[model samples]
Target: MYVTTPDEMRRIDNRAIEEFGIPGAVLMENAAIRTVNVIEEKYPALFDGGRVIILAGCGNNGGDGLAIGRHLMLKGAKVQAFLFFAEEKFTGNARLNLDIYKRLGGHIELVTHEEDIKTLKGSIYQADLIVDSIFGTGITRDIDSLIYKAVDMVNKSPVPVVAVDIPSGINGKDGRIMGIAIKAQHTVSFGYPKRGHILYPGREYTGRLHVVPISLPQDSSQAVGVKTFTLDDKEMAQNLMERPRQGHKGTFGKVGVIAGSLGMAGAACLTSMAALKGGSGLVTLGCPASLVPIFQSKMTEVMCYPLEDGQKGYLTLDAITGIRDFLKDKDVLAIGPGLGSKCDGLEIIRYILREFDISIIMDADALNHISRDKRLLSDYKGSIVITPHPGEMARLTGKSIQEIVASPIETATEFARDMGIIVLLKGAVSIVAHPEGNIYLNSSGNAGMGTGGSGDVLTGLIASMVAQGYSPYDAAVYGCYIHGRAGDYAREKWGETGMIAGNLLDELPLVFKDLFSLKG
Candidate 1:
């Protein structure tokens, strides 16, 4: 399923109308009907005959509320439509909905001034439920002081509030609160979920999410492209169930990971160990010749390839050509985390992405190098995946980490689709965006994963998944899920504070069992 922003949603709507011949009004009506189901199920008693107040703005979101108001009133509920923007503020289908609603004898009220707000206070408090449709996704800038005060009143009010689409006052693109936001007990979302519904702060504000399909054609959203996606265990089971049996080591695939340097050899060790644990049939850890012995001493399972070493046991471009042999018959490749890109790491990475045909996972310094020159994206010849935490993604996209954090879902999705690569933007509710505009949101992992080397493990795990049979999207999604689950399991034994990336390597078998054990 795709998680999209307000603007991107509009594009989808436009494509539906222009290309698929689905009219705008038809979509709005469908949205209202679909949302009605959630409303009915959650508050059956309230919708029967109790007083209901809908605080609606002058947009499609408000239109959805107004349409619902008509339905509830016809069903014999005492419904009051609080039109926040008055008559002149109405536009498009919104205006049409209000006109029809009023004509149908649906109760309507205006909230124009502070006095009007005070006048409605008693009704607001007495109402069983208030539908917050005011200032939906269209609200990108800071709201007026009046609306801010209203937000306080709504949150403070004893009446439970339900939000339409995204929570009112949320910047859907970045999940930032626009001045203030509605505190919803439930948010009825049309089509799939949105970034604000999944990303933090805004996610908390969204409350319980109720997703409804609003009669858009099958895959109709594909026209304008969707950049956000979410993954659950159902996804893992689906991917796992699809894997063929009787697959030999060659059929499963191999991954060559070029990692580890002076002090970061632990990164290589953990990543190599994790690659094998993550289902890679075979893994070769290509490190500076000096590190090979250290890696070998640590693990007999992984093959350690020694590259030409230089001063103080580091890798240079001189040693990059040697990586070619390891590439033979390799299914996927991962670079960075511990690879000393200081000498020729960036150049080596550039050469490999430009020259190698295998699927790739770029992380840590590799991401940093690409941040310096995004031109590397256009020059690449094969399927690609980049796992960048907020900071790294910010560096790669020239956005501040603060900005990205506010809307990791949107920024990551846009960047991935725009650059034509699969992007795993790591953080809470990690987002996976593919070049085709499909996106996946991960639902696993815990706070225990907030440690070093977790990312390196993820890089290796994703590369392993890609090598084994997963698409770039599937690889990133499953890799993050398993990585998080490993952390979760580790947390159970070691507690969040004691859990570390190395702990995940030993717990990988447990994670695999949990995944494969799930019944259809």
Candidate 2:
């Protein structure tokens, strides 16, 4: 799955025409055919002498709808090609499609005036299906007048609506609504899924997303700097090899998790369990010696190593010697869950970055410390991954939280490129930015994942992946997707208010199992 910008999609389309020598009409025809096929397959009743009302505009999306209407009419399905744009405005292949539909005795009407929109209300509501092809990726401004009323009617109408490419009134680049958007029951997007269909209110409006491959060549898309990415599950499933049988604990990987304090022993326990669930064969918890009994009692499976106790049972610089000793046998490290920002805890993090030679994943207060000391940004001997909420990212980059949240894509890419680390800026739209300038946006998870210990769980998951021989970038992106997906699963069963970190932890096994099995 890739999140493509409207500009990128248009660029891809043009590249297909120019570089690949594929005609634009051919792509449009293929898209229209696929759209009609999906509609007929999804709703067999639509072909039973029921009429389809097409709300077409003067753009290419409208062209797709008009072509679909013509196809349906040719197939003996009652169809009405109700359009909003004046007939003179249809251009190129779109105008050609309008001519074909008219010759086939299709009903074509305009609703340029507000009164026209009001008059067609009953005809639209009476139709069995409404095709929302008014505006697609080309929509870039506020919607008003008849178009607004049309979007409103689609929302209130009893007829089902299928959107083309993207729902009308949604910005294809940003997920923001132009003014009003159609609530479509199905969206048959061609070539690839747009960014709007994956984010917020736009995603809510796009009911079921079905991707239809047009005549565009994938190689042409890459030539035009189409670097936008979508995290597809089946691709990730094929990434890592399954666990080797007849292998011992050390054969899998050893993950060292430096977490927990006096009052936050639960955080440490959560991270340890998540690491195990994330497929780390061996996990070691490094914490103040005071909480040894608590880890031993709460997490009997993990090997808890005692470190020097600093203020309030936090690890200080005195734990550096023991940390180095622990790291000698560890494959990956995750720090900053319950570790309070004592001087020792801060120094411990700095020491690990400067001296350690394994993969490191940071979260919570660790990112906070890195944000304060700008000098520590370049002090990494091994691959580094940082999972941060907007506030943490803001602190790390010396930017306001609003600034970080406003354009997360730019923020994460900027920080990761500058610091030479992979940054997973977490939220509804989790971004994975690598030093190589690749950014992956995650579309998993629900509102239930906003609870506590979620970040720790993500940290553990990433560390587990790194320990299991995954690159830092892959580990971070895959971990964010799985962690969020597990949260989504928990939410489906427990509901938002009922969901807890423990529920996500409980669903991790099921999520992993289902994702891997789906590869078949």
Candidate 3:
């Protein structure tokens, strides 16, 4: 599904009214009806003569609340509409709805001053549910302090709140909260989900989301280009990498992973084990010669290579020659998981970027090395995937961590577009951006996946997908989805607090099993 910005949504709405001939009043009525349906379907108990207080503004969102009040009244419920603006300020579809609601004997109250907030506290306390229509997606500034008092009162109330379009005080273009936003139990959006509905902080406030088709023609949305989308479990399950019944070990593809130094040996072990568990036919863990015995003792399934090292346990400049020889039969190379930065290691990364063939998943210390000279990525020819968390992304983009975290989707998209590479900005909501300008927000994973070596598991999984013939872009998308899903599985088995990176690796097979079963 498309996730549109507020401006894009406005353009689409205008196209619906002017070009498609869907009247604005008709759209408003439809939006209100859908919100009513959500309340009926999800909170049927609200219809048992419970008091519903509609906190309405003076705009179309308020119109939606007024229309909903009329519908709730028809359902034999005690509905009260509280208009925040003066009665004369109502105009457009909002005015039409308010007039109809009043003509239908719907009780409307005014909350025009600071004193009105104190008077409304009794109504708020007595209500079973509140409809938050104070602001809509077009709101771009902080709300006034007077409105803040009312919002805070509603939040403090134990009543369930349902929001229309989006929660008030949320930036529609971005998910940032404007002063304060309504904490809604559910949000019924018209036509499609807005960026705020899916983006952070906003998503947190938008309890549950239901996008209703409010008479807007689907083609109108296509008229305005939509390149941003999110991946769901069903789609990912169906599009997962294929598995042939007659497939042999070699049919799955081989992955070459150069990771781990001395103290960070766990990074290498986790990456190699995850690659094998992620369905790679073979996984070779190439580490410093000193770390080989450690890995050999740790995982019997993964093949091990001890390359010549300049340092005691890190892959040095000399190791690149051996890695080149090792890549002869490998389908994908996954570099940089705990491979600490040293002078020789940086030189090896530079060599790999310029000289490596086949797809490469550059992550961890490798990304740190490239961040020093981003120009190394300027002329790279092969398929490339960069997995960087916010801190790593900050280093790569030369931006502050706060800047990257505030707008992960934009940061990932811009970097991918400029570098001509796939960039997966790992976060609570992982964003996968293709060089072609398409961006995907992953819908899987949980906070428990933040454990150490978790990124290494993602690196291995992505490389495994690439080895299995997925394009670098698809690999990143599917890799993030699967990695997150596995983390969720691990969390389910062992609570989120106890789950570790190895648990995520252990659950990869279960995640793939479900995906493959979906294909059948």
Off by over 4 Å in 3: 518-520
User: What's the CA error at residue 305 for candidate 3, in Å?
Assistant: 2.1
Regions more than 4 Å wrong, model 2 = none
Ten-residue region with minimum lDDT total, candidate 3: 341-350
Q: What does candidate 2's lDDT look like per residue over 19-85, in tens digits?
A: 7788888998999999999998988887878888888998888889999998887776788877888
Best model per lDDT: 3
lDDT of 3 by residue, 1-520 (tens): 7778889889988988898788999999899888899999877887889899999999988999999999998997899999999989999999999999999999988898878887789999999889999899999889877788888888888999999999998888777899989999999888888888877888899988888998888676678887777776777878876779899879999999988988999998898888888888999988898778899999999999878786477777778788777888899999899998763667887777777667889999999988888877756888889999999999999899999999898899899988888999998888999888888877688988889999999999999888887888998989999999998898889989888999998899998998888777
Question: What is candidate 1's lDDT per residue for 127-232, written digit by digit as tens?
Answer: 9988888877767688776667777888899898889998888888767788889989999888777777877768889989888887776675566666556666
Is candidate 2 or 3 superior in lDDT? 3
Candidate 3 clashes: the total is 0
Whole-model lDDT, candidate 2?
0.84
Worst 10 residues of 2 by lDDT: 218-227
Supply the TM-score for candidate 3.
Answer: 0.96
